[model samples]
Target: MLKSQRLIRMIMIINARKSFTVQEMADEFGLSTRTVTRDLLELSELGVPIYSIQGRGGGYRLLQERLLPPIAFTESEAVAMFIACRSLRHLSALPFDEGAESALHKFYHYLPEDSKTRIDRLKDKVAIWSPHRQVLPDCLRTLMQSIMVRSVVAIEYRSTHGVELRNIQPVGLYESDGYWYCPAYCFLREDYRVFRADRILAASLNESIDCREDVEQRTLWDLPQERAPLIPMSLELSPGGVHALRSDQWFGESIRVRDDGGGTVTVDIPSDKIPFYSDMIWRLGEDARIVAPEEAVEYVRRKIEAMRLRYS
Candidate 1:
């Protein structure tokens, strides 16, 4: 094999093995030990994080933060990746904020001059805008780690009720509307609950509580199945309301456009979500009206009456 191909293959092997002697690599590559040693020295200089072990049972091993093998990407693929990373700039917090920023910088720095110019232009034109929420979820990484390891965590969380401590086995983490949500099996509730990450003041491994194996198997996609009973609801929307609702991720799919540009949203919403839908529709003012489900309409009515009394 060409030296370049051999080097790339060796990097992949090192990453997979993590700890292997020079003789092992030499045997695998059918190269002399001296040649493998020299190649290892070259890889070390190229920032592979390789180190030698002097004692018995210790061969060469990569550091904890080992370098990844190189992969080729077409210009278009590179540009697409660049755009995907750029779109996350609006998020206030990320699980790997520093790593994302560093990777973006490094990737952008190496792009061809013309690609850089194209990206510079696109930076002004394209954006995946998310609402700028000020609250940062300090426990995002902890929640992510808990999900990966299927561990129970004790969290100090502030909810609408008040601050409280709970032990939870995290199912997964997801971001929607610029906020992170952790769906977990709460020990206090003895059921699954979605906790806002920003409201989590602190999170640490709960060694006393055993992680639920069933919770670990649950995913964000499984949430809808676990929701409260679905109740049929309908909304009448003006053209402007239809336009606005078309951009809503959760509600957009339920909208059925009319011939006159107006639309109706027909959805089977969970009973517990009635107040949330009511508040959202109420904010649309005259543009939206509840067509069915007296519960949601009454909620809006009470809100309006409460506001009117406050103003009076």
Candidate 2:
């Protein structure tokens, strides 16, 4: 169990590293080939970097920015990237605007025959994404350029609350669930921070800012804790509560689903939003309960009183 978990983490964490074949990995790790393959599929569902390649010339390669020149995308890959980009256009800085006319022109020029066929198929099946629409065009372009160049950037940004102006040095550009983000160093806070691209009022390439040695590995797969103090606890959730965990649309990553039936969820969060998380549990009422870290029960009590006062 520990070995498979380790393999999953290895494959998931290094987005750029190539993966061993099932036989190679299994033999090296002393596991059955089936188990190794299973772990790979599981990693894929969590949006890990693992992907399969075909042909006698192909095996598996995890994509990293610096190694590959402008890449040729298969139809599925291109459409997947476009879909992600479309979503990111809303939430983060986009280095390219609708005017990716040039990039799109370049992108189309490199398509393999198979990828061209796939693009046509995807055109027949259109998809849409919803994100905060305020993000600007050039912001995205800078993000793309930064990701490709591994360059540092300076951004004058406003917070989600629209109350703060922060100057930050971006480390990497990222697209998470259709939103574009940069996890970077904040000169003001002197801490690592995540900034939505859409919120940046202005940006420029800042040759002065460099990668910080203090940066830590973070899971875009799992959101980092909030900067503000929060009450952390675990809770059991109901069927409907589990359904809410499907996307960050309502509740977020803290309320995670477990088991296949959408019957159990685990949450760790702040008392500030007690009503938000706990009331979600209370609404599920009998279906959810505080399971660990006793402080959660009081948070829930506060939520109940707020609900009572509101109803009264």
Candidate 3:
């Protein structure tokens, strides 16, 4: 292939993966529609998963599989991935720019005719993932390192009132918004559970820890959904509270969530596992109200009454 033809291939692989049309490519390349179409076909023939769509909110996408593990991304695709990865910088503060460059090198290795300067310029202009100044504890990072290695994490966490040692076996590390969380099986509670990264007073990898590295840790999340006694209860949620109520890595799947009003939403939940619900209500304060599963309603009522007494 000529330099221009190779550059065209690079452009299709990187830039046209999403939201680009063959017609648009033809116009940009100063080629006939059939020529652009043939180029896309050639890309597919060379083990690319580029597929097109027609409709509102639809465009092209390149499917990734084990067979086609590495391929160059266009300037925009590189920028987009960089932006997305930048968002995770808070999980650990490190130089991801360098890491991304190494990743791009492997991806773009086959495209000798590609414009490196253009790709770098596009990366410089790209922005997406926002970084925060929050500091993560070294212990917390160590625990996460263990989870990445599929090793057990032992924790000494302080409870809500900040006065208790809860020991747990970490199953996974997950992040939501700006906070990191460790989902694990609590040996003290004798049940599967979720623990916040901020609350973990101590965390370490124990060499003696014995657990199945083979069992998909997602089962820990499923435990919450499959608790023998279902609450079958519902409640109205506040809009502000709605966003935070999304399932964390350990929170499991949401059965349902419906907006009832500017200040309300309805949901069903288990009473025993009401910590997630109660925590959200506490976060929302007066904005939300419980409606059904009399037990849940009563639990909310007692919690409110206790708050009243404490203030009184």
Top of the candidates by TM-score? 1
In candidate 3, what are the lDDT values of residues 135-217, reduced to their tens digit?
34676667656655666666666676665665556666656655666667766667777777767666677657565544335
- TM-score, candidate 2, is 0.47
Q: Estimate the overall C-alpha local distance difference test score of candidate 2.
A: 0.61
Comparing 2 and 3 on TM-score, the stronger one: 3
Q: What is the lDDT of residue 48 in candidate 3?
A: 59
lDDT of each: 0.84, 0.61, 0.58
Distance from true location, Cα of 285 in model 3, Å: 5.7
Worst 10 residues of 3 by lDDT: 247-256
Q: Is candidate 2 or candidate 3 better by lDDT?
A: 2
lDDT of 1 by residue, 1-312 (tens): 999999999999999999999889999999999999999999999778989999877679988776777767788898788878888888887765377777788788888898888878887587788777655545887787777666799999998789999999988887877888888889999988888888888988876888877776777887636468989889999999999889786689989999999999988888988987787788889899998799988888899899999999
Which stretches in model 3 have alpha-carbon errors above 4 Å?
A: 1-71, 89-135, 160-168, 187-190, 213-228, 237-265, 285-287, 293-312
Superposing every Cα of model 1 onto the true structure, what RMSD results? 2.5
Candidate maximizing lDDT: 1
